[model samples]
Target: MFFSLIFSLCCVTAWALPQYQPQYYSFSPTVGRGHGESFASVGEGRITGVRIWEQSNSYIKGFQLKYENVWTPIYGSTSNEETELLLFEGEAIVQISGKYNPPNYIYCLRFVTSRGRSLIAGQPTGNSFNFYPVDGQSELQIVSGRSDGTGIASIGAHWALIYRNDSKALT
Candidate 1:
């Protein structure tokens, strides 16, 4: 009887516990687009996992990666049906709902879709975004600096990745 109780407790604890997710992170508008670069700047230390939401033809699609926070492409081969349930598993560094670029810091991520369309997420018509609708676009990119192209390091056009964060450690 005690052994069974212990087993049940362990199962409950595992299901109830929360996973490790970054407290601060940004999403790249470029994710989910056909093929383009979008940079989302995140603090060197605060970023742990980045979930770049993919968009195509005005529809939110599948996820690029489960847990990753680097200015790189979180490539994932998925279908278009995933758009209705756009999400990042567990917790992540940032949620790229669309068009919401972080100031002074960007988190660049690569994204592309089988369908070619100009992807733009977020409430372009309204302020204070509460959600990102299903949409598709050609490409998207999250910047690491100001909203406008001004001050901030760059590799040229956009996107700068040093390596893949497999361990999910912050810099």
Candidate 2:
């Protein structure tokens, strides 16, 4: 039983990151600082890890990834949704399937401060989009399903990233 448990854990750990690609190349226009660098993901539970860094020197302030429902993701086990993380603020969210249709779900992240206060926010972008969460800030979005909610495999979104324009900032 112990061996089996260990083996299962190892296997699970290995099957975390999504095999798909990324879908957007947008940065925060309001960010008075760095540009996003890259991401690292391993699709495990209902959520994965994405690393977004500081443009100046890749000082990662946060990352984005999907949360795998663990018990049953999509059709059975392979369907998982994306989640975003704002490390600077220590915030995260999971996409829960909504009661709507085709792809009925939303992305939300919440965290508390050392002082003690609930912080939660939803992903403004759909499966794929060119969005700016806060004006003058960096832009991050997803790109996998249609505008309405049809899923499509796009490598462009699997591991896609956009660098900051040193000469031309978003603002």
Candidate 3:
């Protein structure tokens, strides 16, 4: 009886374990001196995490994530890249600084899913970044200019999505 109970407990625990599937997408946008935007759409599923990279030397004046009818501002110093592990549903829109007829700027993004699956649409690389959980949606929308709407730069983005998994809700 003791052995049987232990086996049952183990099975139950294994089944309850959270499974994570990671998906990745990359985008290259040529934002010039003015304003620009980039984004990606995900199928049905929950977004567990996100990562963004700015390949250009220019500073990102500001950035925001839009989905459904809500817009969430991304807080952080103007850096080359950023990451977050916030949970979001449906599609996602990434809006960033842009320039009019500017140089070529490259940006990348990654999305982690609750399920242990991922679909990559661009080149994958080895790099370390940080991600945190925040509130937002999972849809693509037009890029609204910065608060000042006067920055000379371009933006690119990549996204990842998972189609299946067994993970608990992200608190």
Better candidate number, 2 or 3, judged by TM-score: 3
lDDT of 2: 0.28
Residue range 30-94, candidate 1, lDDT tens digits: 32222323244333322233333333322222233221344333333233323222223221222
Q: Which stretches of candidate 2 lie over 4 Å from their true place?
A: 1-40, 48-50, 57-171
What tens digits encode model 2's per-residue C-alpha lDDT throughout 1-171? 999999999989889856685444343221111112222233542222232222122111222344333221221011223233322222222121111111332232233222233333334333332223232232223322212112211111222222444442222
**Cα RMSD (Å) per model?**
17.1, 19.8, 13.7
Clash statistics: count for each candidate: 43, 42, 29
> What range of 10 consecutive residues in model 1 has the weakest lDDT sum?
148-157
List TM-scores for all candidates, in order.
0.20, 0.17, 0.25
Candidate 3 Cα outliers beyond 4 Å, as residue runs: 25-153, 161-171
Best by TM-score: 3
Regions more than 4 Å wrong, model 1: 27-171
Candidate 2 global Cα RMSD: 19.8
Cα lDDT for residue 1, candidate 2: 100
Q: What's the ranking of the predictions by TM-score, best on top?
A: 3, 1, 2
